[model samples]
Target: MAQNIIHLVNVSKNYNGTEALRNINLYIRKNEFLTLLGPSGCGKTTTLRIIGGFEAPDGGEVLFNGVNITSVPPYKRRVNTVFQKYALFPHLNVFENIAFGLKIKKMDKKLIAEKVHNILGLVNLSGFEQREIDSLSGGQQQRVAIARALVNEPEVLLLDEPLGALDLKLRQEMQIELKNMQQRLGITFVYVTHDQEEALSMSDTIVVMKEGSIQQIGSPIDIYNEPKNSFVADFIGESNIVSGIMLRDYLVKFAETTFECVDHGFKENEPVDVVIRPEDIQVVPAAESKLQGEVSAVTFKGVHYEMIVQNNSTRWKIQSTAMAPVGAKVGLQILPEAIHIMKKVTVK
Candidate 1:
């Protein structure tokens, strides 16, 4: 079993009396790529900061290697951060920028040069040693910032939306690069981002947050396919969420029709939330299906067309290769495996 490198025990934080984190209990395993995913004000960034020792929680403790370190300063912790704004020295070249930390420790010149070159090579910038910071592109500068943080060989790396400043194409490219880099380095990564696709693409485990609290934690596939509630289903991707009743194990009633589902564990006749992904819904001829809806909208989305079908007050978003014309009656076939039943959540 992999040992946990860090743990936040009942951690809570506040900013001017408003809660930033609410009793967040989290553990980061060694050498795993974990992402804290949520929207703004969700406290993903604040969680990362707490782990990096940049911010301290108002209650509870932070543990590093099983030892309490809640009060430790940022510089003393065995972690480093890479922020959205790649904080490189404007006057310094790439070499000087990466070497600043080692030099500040008063290390020998030859050793600093060796470490700087090696780190630059890891970041694929070996030949750009003398290039000025301003001379590099956004991607290159971000690489420099990452290299500087990684050069110190911290046990964990906290990234706060580091790719938010890059263009879409470059950001996607860096996603692959960063994942590969983390695998090659064999280090723990606690990344924070509001982008769901980015979190899904690069994470081994995802912690989804909402309103300063963690909503769910699981592997990306599990989070998407088996969301704990409607909030997770609606946030992780495009989902058709509807109120339903669990008629029995493997059976549910929604849209005035009963469906055979793969989920259970709910009380008999219990009200639940049904989550069906857009792609999981199969479109068929209305005459062949018991349930039918009228096509209200159709949108071409590259490989597939997104369709909105209206059945009374319920609007279903379905994705299919074939497009049904608006006003056409279509059948939505939700297979047993595609129907995900979740416990309904009540807000206080």
Candidate 2:
């Protein structure tokens, strides 16, 4: 059984009357890469800070390995954090920066040296020990910051947008590297980021938060394919959310057309939101399409093509393998598996 390394029970945080997190109950499994994903102003970072002991919750308790550590100070917790800015000391070299933590714990010089060397190698910075901090590229400096955090052997490592500063290519590379390191070390990683692709690519469990509330918690595939709500479906990937009426258990009506879907459990004539991912759409010859539309615009995105199709005044974004020229009559076909119907939430 996977151990629950960290548990938050009825956790709520408030700042001057503004609710930052509302009754958050979460259990982080041992060695699992849990990602708290959302856009800006979401409670992802707030929750991470609370878990790291950087911020205290106004209510509830935090348990680490079944031991209550709600009131524990930052230094007392077995957690390390990597911020967006590489917080390395400008005056210290790479080696001394990593050794600073171990030295404070009063570890012997020989042990510190050995540990630092191993970590440097692990982070692929074996020969840059004596190099100046400012001499490294953005990616290298970021790796050093990660090395500093991991060197302490913390049970949980909290990373808040660690790769946010790197370029696109570097970010992709680091994502794989970080996952590999996490698996090899068997340390739980709690990552906070607004990038949906990052969360989907690396996380074992993704907790989608919004406006101080938990929206959904599920695996990458589940969040991408079967979003719990309209916000989740739209936020996790490129989804076209259309208003639909449930006509039957496996059927919904959209855009004056009744279509078959896989979603069940809905009353007849219930208002719902149908989510169809762009990649799930198939474009056929106009005469062969179930839904006919004219291609409004087309843009080549290197590997695949992106096209905008228009039916009346309603527009739909389609990504397909077969490149369709602009002004062409195209038939848009969405498979039954691609249709995800969610009950519309009525706002007061």
Candidate 3:
């Protein structure tokens, strides 16, 4: 088992009386890629700031290697942050920017050169050492920011939406590059982002957050497949969520239909929320299946067709390779495993 390298114990923070984090308890394993994911004001960034020593929590402890370091300053911690804004010095060349920290420590001049060269190579900018910061593209500049942080050889790296400024294609490319870099370096990465796809693709563990609290923490697969509630299901991907009742073990009733699902442990006849992914639903001929709907809207989504099916008051979004014309009656087939059942939440 991997040992934890960082822990946030009952951490709470507030910004001018508005709670930013409430009793957040988290454990980050050494050398793992963990992402704190949520929408704006959900405390993901605040949590990252706390870990990076940028902000101290109103209450609780921040531990590094099981040692409390809540009050430690950012510069004293063995971690560096890469923000959305690269913050590269406009007048400095790539080498100078990356070597700034090493020079501050007054390391051997030759050793600083060696570290800068090595980090530049790692970030695929080996030949751009003398290039002025302003001459580099956005992606290259972001890489320089990362290279600067890595050149410090910190044990952990904190990233706050580092890819947020890039174009769609560049952002997608950097997502893969960042994951590869983390794996190659064998260090802990604590990332903060609101992009669900980015979190799912790059993180080993994903912590879902909501207003001032952590909602769930699990592997990307677990978080996507077995969401704890409707919010996670809706946020992580395209889901058809509706009110349901657990009729009995392995049985659920929703949309006036009783179906067999692989969910249990709920009280008999208990209310629940059923989450069905758009990709899990198969579009079939209406005559062959029991549940039917009219395809009210259809759009080609490159890999598949996204069809909005209307069955009276409920609208379901489904993705399938087979195209069903709008206004045509179609059937939806949801397998037992795809029918994830989550406990319902009460609205405020």
Clash count of each predicted structure: 0, 0, 0
TM-score of 1: 0.94
Pairs with backbone N, CA or C atoms under 3 Å apart (clashes), candidate 3: none
Residue 283, model 2: Cα distance from true site in angstroms: 0.8
* CA displacement after TM-score superposition, residue 160 of candidate 3 (Å): 0.7
Assess each prediction's global lDDT (C-alpha) against the native: 0.90, 0.91, 0.91
lDDT of 3 by residue, 122-145 (tens): 777888989999899988898899
Better of 2 and 3 by TM-score: 2
* Number of the top-ranking candidate, with TM-score as the measure: 2
Which ranges of candidate 2 are over 4 A from the true structure? none
Q: Report how far residue 263 has shifted in candidate 2, in Å.
A: 1.6
**lDDT (C-alpha) at residue 212 in model 1:** 91
The alpha-carbon lDDT assigned to residue 78 of candidate 3 equals 89
Least lDDT summed over 10 consecutive residues: which range in candidate 2?
Answer: 312-321
> How much does candidate 2 score in TM-score?
0.96
